[model samples]
Target chain A: MLAAPFQAEFDANSQEFSFAGVVRPRSVDEIAHSISMFRNAIEEARGVLYINVKRLAQMNNTAFHAFSRVVLDACRTRSDIRFVVVTSSVVGWTERMFRHLGKIEPQITVEVYDSKFYPGQAFVEDTSFIPILRTQTKMTWRHERKILPRHGMRPGITMADICCGIGDFAVLVRKEFQPARIVALDHSKASLAYARDVASNFGISDIEYSYGDASEMLLEDNQFDLVTCRHSLQIFNQPDLLLKELYRICKPGGRVYITNEKNSHCLGEPRAQSIQWTYNEVARLFAHFEMDVELGPKSRRYLADAGFDDILVESFMVTNQDGDPQDFADIITAWENVYAGEMAVKRGDPPEFIKRFRQGFRDHIFAALHPKGYAGWPIWAASGRKPL
Target chain B: MNAAHRQPAEPKFEPLLQFEMEMGTFLSDWHHCDQLSTYMARMISHNRTDPLRHSNFFSSALNELLEVSFRGGSPEGRIGCAVYRHGPKERVKISFPCPAGQRQFFREAVARTHGNDAYARYLDALSTDLAPSREVVLLDLAINFDAEIRLEEQDPPSITIVVDLPLEGIVS
Candidate 1:
């Protein structure tokens, strides 16, 4: 009897129906009744459904779960009906939630757009983005090398890197693991081109570059011996969809490795405090999903639920003390490059404030380096084996 | 007549025909140096009846000079070219107005300091007897060539390099 949180209109020409408005249903009965009406409309119209979640400001977990179950059930029962969820985000945590939902129902597809920087585009064109990614690659490789061998990563194995930005990790795997072949997949052609250029520069010949959404890869099932997604899981619109794809393409007994930053801290500064506050705010926004926005502690549960076995989770801290000053500078530059624009718009910070913060942070970092300035961050590495 | 009394006919010298070209400040990046050099080479070749030989000669010569300049970390500057014809020979001289960074590199190259053996080796590889002086480095193709550096006192101080390539095989 309560008004449904969404309105559905069928387009006769396109043979598709679109749902728009807030989707925060309060109770099971309300969610069910809404799903029933949407399902009946889809069946009657005999067209695809596109749920536009742009105006969907909030969705509680119970309502979201019910909505996902109904959609999946509809897809499973009606072979002719298709469903697509379209969402956009300017912040990291919101993107994570959408991506998580994508994995919940493999039959359903989720499309996410970056509404702020690089709007509606998958590849980032900023000149500074690649350099920052390169710096982060070095930091990540150091942690990855520790556990890769134990997880079936070795010489002569076929590997697929999902969301492999710029092919840095693929090249790293080639150098360290000696994989027989590597297929680096990303959605951004620009990123792929840059990766190919880098691979060419490095004289690496065995990599096959492909561009597509990792959630729905065009790769053969059970083809890869190892699949790895590093530092990208938290930002994916549907981490679960990609994980399912990772599991599907991976050979029986093959392994999948995923790692993400838990938290980053700078020594002797207010910058760390400020960053922590921002992260907390983001986490609070998605508290309904029970997601630990910073560390992504729920990733293990998601992996297990996706039918992975012998799951292992480990944490390590990397410190920037006594490292190259240029590397430290690059880290700071990368942070500013990624978060500055979004944070500026979200927090209404003026240009002067942003500039002062960047300069102040840099000075603080340099000043802290006296008897070895300490800057450190925590990362979580989780891996699981596909059932044979 | 006595052998000394009968003076030998003065060696005939042909009238000098000159060609000049200049590039602007916009095309003054290290990467654009090759492009400008290639353009100069083509211009020299355009006037010759045997375009192939002239093109190959100028192209190789300009490329070698550009390489040495780049290896020495020379700052790219405004480029100019002058071509002169004398009898059966043609001399193509390419000049560059050097900034202080390039001037310093050239001085080190001349002094053979700062572990600059690479530039020295390039110079030695290209030297010939037709070199104007010991200080001048020549790139001796079938055509003879020589390089000279001139320093001028100005507000910022500038160095100029004049490379003279004399074509020997082609007869006009």
Candidate 2:
């Protein structure tokens, strides 16, 4: 006699039906009311009717059978109406299970959403970039450990690290906060493999490193007390799509944490002008690839537009002075190779321009290693509370 | 398992997780299927290459089998579920209340899903417009998941069913 922990909503404007939550019932009779509502909605719909089960975390055979019947019957009755069953790759069985109906009914088609939405995933997926990512985190974690508490992180809370590249940040969070549970997800299989290997080698068995698309994730709604997606929103071509998903998974009264870099703001002494020009080009370079390396200051607008409130935004400088200058120099060295060597060449920049760009990174590293020098990379850390 | 269908030298399976409850209690609430399936999937999928993806597939398959146990058999006996693993293969074993006639019905239903025409029959059954209480769990799991299903008669009013799912090896 427990209440059904699921919902179905029909939108007349787009002719889409959304099913969410755990959709299990004792029998078809138990959901006859919702079934009749579905039947009526399809009767008046025209063109394509989208049945979005991307957020439908679980469904039983009884419910699936009932839904299949309704969709197939609707297809047979309305020849003009096409049914598109939208499933998410995060939920493994939905596409395959519903795909059978797509095969049997010509009018029905099943499309998995996450498989196609990762616009700039390739830049971050390279296994060769793993070391730089680790160095970047080692530098940032110092500032983040201080900033995280101001953003609602605490012990024993459920947490999720989306776009958790290589999962070093999640491991740091696990050790520092000791959250009750942590689920770290990323789109890169290679990155996750490395992350899994690192965690296992260290005997850190608590964190769950999962593979998933950031824009259209498979994690359920309102599950995490604190959700962190660091240095990720900028890399995705469609930042809003990724932000919307981050908002969706955050629990009411919880917070979504993010960090992004405005690459042009990078600074160094003794080679200030050259470094400035190169970092600006780095921003432009990322833009050419449909990513925004200069999205740091826009975090407030992004979070507010996604319907979050009590937004807290702060900026931190990861400088050579923060730690060993060697670590900072190493990160810059990797960046030069990827940005000027690979990316500029791919962008078809002149050799002279690539050489000049490479020079700026070399100067920044020089400044980092110089006894009287300073080099800094500024990042914005922002968090917004999901209203209760 | 039938001697005719058993694998020549299947790998040994060690029990990983188990849950036990009376049939009447489990059947009394429909939410158990969802809650239990979600919990078990999360528990068993931690080591897969894609834990989220593997868990989703495992949960879907487990939910279907749990539903079959929920709807079939009498409500006067105990029901138990045990999960076992051998590398990438995961097996779910469920024991539930059943009568002799209901056991025969299940055996015959499972039998229909073994041959080459099983998937086609599954499609046909889906579109046939049977009664409101139509049962097609076995056929769907058997064909869609390529599950290896075995049913064993227990005491007078109970039966145990085992399903082996090679979830990680699947391309999708």
Candidate 3:
């Protein structure tokens, strides 16, 4: 369960000693060498020595006792150098535990680093995009409901839907699966508000909508039977970190299910070439924003590399044939606005490029509403079981 | 129902989860304190309003208790942990066979934590170069968590430490 060992590093440039992972040793005897290294770093620091415990998930009282003494003694002796305890709120006890250093000596201070985990949070969290998000979920849910059972989802199991956009899928899964518990978490406060409203209107009292950063979730380890993060991994700059978290929260023998789109593969008959060009551009546009819109087929390699066993991956197409063609058309239209109007414009694309970029989405919409049209949005669904 | 006119229902806590393990084996390693606290926190806190946050706080509090027991108690009998709740309040009861020294430690620590100068004692415990601190961990649960804690003698040489945690709001 302790995948990473306790380690400390000193950066002279930053005047910091950052500690990560579990650091519980019997007395200070086991960690005397590391403490000495930390002490040396503190002694050398001129103005300030920051002791960062942002990733230090757990520390027994024995370890903390040793650490606190070092800081206190340093404050008394090294009057010139100041001490700052940089902590992450992800580990709930850290700020409170380290706050005493600041209280005992004014030279020592504690600061909790909480925000800016998600760079694109502001843009994606805009409430105006919620309509398009709901429509995207609506179309995808049709294929996912059938695909889910094939990927270790069943009734009566505990579930967590990380990055649960607009909470539409959680509602659908709750209605379909009747899970014992469903904790739907998202970084967007606006998205969560919309999701909770939808749940309340539907009289669905079971689903718990929580606000969180998916990459560094406060959720406990091995808590859920099935952990689902749909259409989210491709958007992050670091998908591996997210996969590690998904792997951590899922119980041994439980499955982590994810879905992402290889956007360039989206096809529409009669305007296939135009649609293809637009999606390829869409992939590049997202890449410029540090996101990968073409992470679909790579799902297998990601799960396998993350030490998962019994991987299951499948591709599904949400076509104009499903429920309403307008819904499929709406998803494309919204994509054009965000991708071409917002993302492309932000990338400083010329008018000539933006004009042509907007036309492809219009053609895709026309094809979707056409009598004999077969417009399609391709998605990859993958799941891997955590080894027991 | 109107916001002002309608009366709220009375709060109650019912049995939710309970499990037991051999005290000797569990106390053999310090890591067991973390393992048990983590597993229990994740499994039990899902029913709370905010499961992840609740679990985070619960694990911190529970780990301290488990670690204290690990440091002080004898590995002679069963150590059982039971969690119960049907409302905002959740109760945790950990019962194990204790040596006289362990019992006395809890009695003195609980008394010190409940006194008017509890926060002062906690600060004093932190400032001192106390090895394997007897008071800080228990005092933290009492002061920071706003936990109501007491020790009860179940049988001769066996004792149960009960903690009532109003953990839901403090997290926010």
Candidate 4:
């Protein structure tokens, strides 16, 4: 039986059928049943059957797989029936899923329509205002010591750094590992330009910079010996798809490294306590667009699901004990700038509230700079190898 | 040789105006370029009303263009523009620093204007179909590395753009 959230309309004359609204069928059996009904309808009518998934926002991996299976099955079984899956651009994960479907079943077509729910171009385009906190809090030396050694980098090994903002990690890898070639991918043109500049300045050659959506990379399959994404997984709307892309590009036995801040642990710190509130508010704001924040612990599971083997997960923290106060101030100021501007304004936060939030953030950072005061965020490093 | 070590030269033209701003903020806001172009157009339209306004607009455009050009690189560097009135027809000369190693990029950008005659096309677009009467004219645009004005040795190399905006009714 078709569930309440699922609605289907058919125009017999036009031979067009559409299913829209929340489609949370109870189980795989229900999805199969639904596909059967669509198959029957397609047999009776002639033209294309449009599956309007624009409104189907909340779909798990199982549901996604089930949908893919049904579409592929239909395409294989019935030659007469044509299917067109329509999705919204704002639902990036859904678009990625449909794209994956197209890859598997070349005959079916998927259309992604632009919607207002999508984050404005301005929001994404403003890459010039990257917070100093991002760099300051990175603890590069620590990452170098811990993560780089495990990679066993050597000559003739090709690597790809997805979400390689400004190519910090790429530069590091080139300098430390002496990799024969490295390709850095990022979505922002401005960021890629900066990365190119950085690479030029460092006299680092053999690093190619490309700009595009990381989820849908233009690189060839099984192109790299290794792949890494640093501190960017949580921001991706569909981290699973990103991981799968990483897996796809990575050669057999090549390892994939993923790292992000442990949000829960970081938010629990006394000096970083306010970050929790801010994160929750930001998450709530993003919820309207159906984007979820990945809170650090899910990296391992995502890697495992992507068919990665020999997985290892490590968590560590960095304290600001010997850190420069000026750097901390700059980080705080950067955070304040972001919060006071688009992040707060987009959420309909009042000027007074933004001002207060900025003040509170500054106060926390100032306190963290004191002798007794301590500041840190839990960092997670998860690496896994593709099956040999 | 570092450019900053040279002795600064005296001004050859009469002082007009100066404008300065951070490049990052300007680039992040998409409307700044349009706002700047509109302001320049207005100043050109109002040149007969006040000749001094021509100098101010030249200074503003020079600063804006430099900022837009140097968006992705180090955001820390400050962009400065100085306008001076010179030449036979009260031409306002504007100069601003650009990032080092970017001279080629800027040169290509300037050369790659939509049509063959960039100045004519720019004037037409800026005037928004207004018949080109005796008003203001863009005389010339050039870029150079003046050793006297280089700010820092370690900073990205600087290229100065010289734009001559000639006011119609004034004789400097």
lDDT string, candidate 4, A223-335, tens digits:
67889887777666667878888998788899898877554343423545565555455455444434444446777888889999988888766555535645554655665
**Per-residue lDDT value at B130 in model 3:** 56
Ranking by lDDT: 2, 3, 1, 4
**lDDT, candidate 4, residue B170?**
26
Q: Which candidate is the best by TM-score?
A: 2
In order of TM-score, best first, we have: 2, 3, 4, 1
Q: List candidate 1 segments past 4 Å from native.
A: A1-43, A46-127, A264-293, A346-371, B1-172
Q: Write the residue-wise lDDT of candidate 1 on A71-109 in tens digits.
A: 656766788766676664311112333454445445557
In lDDT terms, which candidate is top? 2
lDDT of 1 at A304: 98
Q: What C-alpha lDDT values do all the predictions have?
A: 0.55, 0.85, 0.83, 0.55
Better structure of 2 and 4 per lDDT: 2
Whichever of 1 and 2 has more lDDT, that candidate is 2
Query: Which pairs clash (backbone N, Cα, C closer than 3 Å) in model 1?
Result: A98-A237, A99-A237, A99-A238, A99-A239, A103-A240, A103-A241
Better of 2 and 3 by DockQ: 2
Worst 10 residues of 1 chain A by lDDT: A115-124
Order candidates by DockQ, high to low.
Answer: 2, 3, 4, 1
| lDDT score at residue B34, model 1, on the 0-100 scale | 45
